[model samples]
Target: MGLDFVTVLFDSPFAVMNTIGLIAFALVGSAKAIREEFDLFGITVVGLAMAFAGGATRDLLVNRVPLVLQSPVEVSLGLLGVGLAVALSVVLRSPENHPITLVADAIGLAAFTTAGAIVATEATVSVFGVVVIGTINAVGGGAFADILLDRSPFILFDDFYASCAVLGGSAYWIMGSVGATGSTAAGVCAAVTVVARLVAVTYSWNLPTVQTLGVLSERMDDQ
Candidate 1:
């Protein structure tokens, strides 16, 4: 079902490979977010939440069945990813690899954004709706993870985090309309999104900070 939707834009072996690659990227990101070892229940919760949190929310809002819930493959892969991340962190105990965390996150965000586009298009949603859903599916997990860890969401403070997802999703939607295959279009969009995000990070490009919010917060506090 997921592939069927993506096939509208990404139709090919390359796209299929890209889809799997992106999911793996997401798993690695979630694993990096896990800072410490825990019991089975704890690990399970983290893995499951990291993997399905975004897709589940996206499906609910869009009035569709959640893909992660319906597919055991996603769940299994998520668990494996989280487990490997934790194990590697424990073994390496080095700061050098910390940078890889951000890379993993960006890859995950890009891939999932494409997936969301595929799904939304399949559902016959509007373009705007596709963008919204795609963005949510891509970054929702990282956002929730940040909240759980008492940190600001990546999209709110990082270099073109959510912006990349938005662009990727929009591109996929456009490609689909042109009669591209699901995997091919999604692959291209995801790749572009990842590159764009990486460049933004490397060059420290960022949106202007909101100045009014600071003043507004001060006045509200005084009241």
Candidate 2:
């Protein structure tokens, strides 16, 4: 049998954005695994899951093939990301104290949300659709990780998670409506999301939930 192999680099603007998000997520996932006292193998798994899950989910939702699965370069980069996370975790040995994980998560959320907005624009989706896609792209990986860890999803329980994504997507949609596209639109989108997320984290801002929700949740707990 004969086989042909070719490289699939994350060379385009969209691909590059997605790759950036992937690496950022890997860092966050690695830190989280370390905080959980996981071994290297567990770290690798969590890192890859956090890295690729969001983008894969976004692609699947858009009816496109997942980039990591189809791209050798992306897969290699993903592995490199995992390896880097492992090295960093071992070196730091105190992941909980470092804020880099939250920073990475914010960056990843912004990048993925912006990329999804761009994809939605190219697909001629509605503004609401763009927000939905972007939000999903931003939080899908983190949500998956939380589910695996048996925790409440970040977007559902924490600081302005999906709101940042929605705002980012709305910015892009408005820019496109005003005849803006390309890097400028992407920059505005990502900036809004990242700034919002970082500020929310810094200030400990959270969405308003029923006070009884927490009480109910605690009461439902096995403990």
Candidate 3:
């Protein structure tokens, strides 16, 4: 069974969620790469970067090898991401705001944020650390890819993006404190995140921002 395979492949809920997040993030990366006119190899590299950059940064900050380097299966997943990137680049005409891209990004955000909360808990971190790690896990990969493409990081501009992850992480931690097991807690937290994200997307909810651009000013100012 699919569930059985998941439980067997991963000894814990975090591992399962992390793996799924990796694949989803990889797809998001590839979509961005295609949009940016990256070559095939570039797409693959971006896929790998988007899939692992955040977790890698988190691990290094904690003084550990990036899981992508330590886990062979994760490397395999990265390659699978590259292969999928190539296929998707051919099939997807519009990478930005495509249903597939939005769904993949939402799934990745849910899975990684919940799993990152679990990791922070296991590491005996503070509540701040839990939220911080979860948010980073959800956005770090995409942020890296955005940097390479010379785009503003979504986490900075997209109000609901990191908010959902933080709420999910907090939910996961609170559920754990209330005697929920890892899988059940993770599920609840991820569900919360996904629902919130989808609702935000549907409603176009956004935090207020000042309109400003250096060279693209609508009203030219006299010096």
Candidate 4:
């Protein structure tokens, strides 16, 4: 089963994206735990949670066993990411907030968003389901990790993050509806998500809050 899973990872683009997402998210989560000064066990737990939470939720929504539970290789990949985070910390101070880690987070988001869209589509869910699942799969792990860290989910009040997944998922649904091949749709979804996230990060873009909008409206009225 392990060998077969590895073969799938090599042969299937979807699986490849899943692998990348797992590793990257694990690293991101582990880094955060390290920043918070978690013990080694806690760090490993957080890393595994970040790597598997979103995918597990997606699988449950689609009525299947979570892939993480089905494969030891998945756990190994996640641990490899955790190991990478530890190594990076030893080499670089505050590696969690480093540019490379941020980039990895964006890539992981894109990969998971694409994976979720593909899985939801295969399950023949509605357009809404596809978008929602994609967004959740992209951000759910981070949210969960935040909770474990005793903080609110950053996505609920944070920068332009989950929206990228929504846009990417919509792109996938539109392209698929128009008869594009699965690969084409997945490619567009991943590209859209990654580009949007990187741009948002580079520019410090964020969605406006209600208070900010109200202030803007008041200024316009005064003008």
The numbered model that scores best in TM-score is 4
Per-residue C-alpha lDDT of model 3 across residues 1-223, encoded as one tens digit per residue:
8778566447788887888888888888987888888888888888888899988877765566777787787877767766776677677788656887788889989988987787777778788888888888888888998898788987777789888898898898889889998888999999999988988888988865556454335566644
Pick out the ten consecutive residues of candidate 2 with the lowest summed lDDT.
Answer: 1-10
Give the Cα error of residue 124 in candidate 4, in Å.
1.0
**List of clashing residue pairs for candidate 3:** none
Ordering by TM-score: 4, 3, 2, 1
lDDT of 1 by residue, 52-109 (tens): 6777878887797876777666665676666656665676664124666667767777
lDDT of each: 0.69, 0.80, 0.82, 0.92
- TM-scores for every candidate against the unseen true structure: 0.77, 0.85, 0.87, 0.95
Candidate 4 lDDT, tens digit per residue, 5-78? 77877676588789899999999999999999999999999999998999999999999999899988789999
Span of ten consecutive residues with least summed lDDT in model 3: 214-223
lDDT of candidate 2 vs native?
Answer: 0.80
Number of backbone collisions per candidate, in order? 15, 0, 0, 0
Worst-scoring 10-residue span by lDDT in model 4: 5-14
Give RMSD to native, each candidate: 6.2, 6.8, 5.3, 1.8
**Models sorted by lDDT, best on top:** 4, 3, 2, 1
Q: After superposition, how far is residue 97 of candidate 3 from its true place, in Å?
A: 2.3
lDDT of 4: 0.92
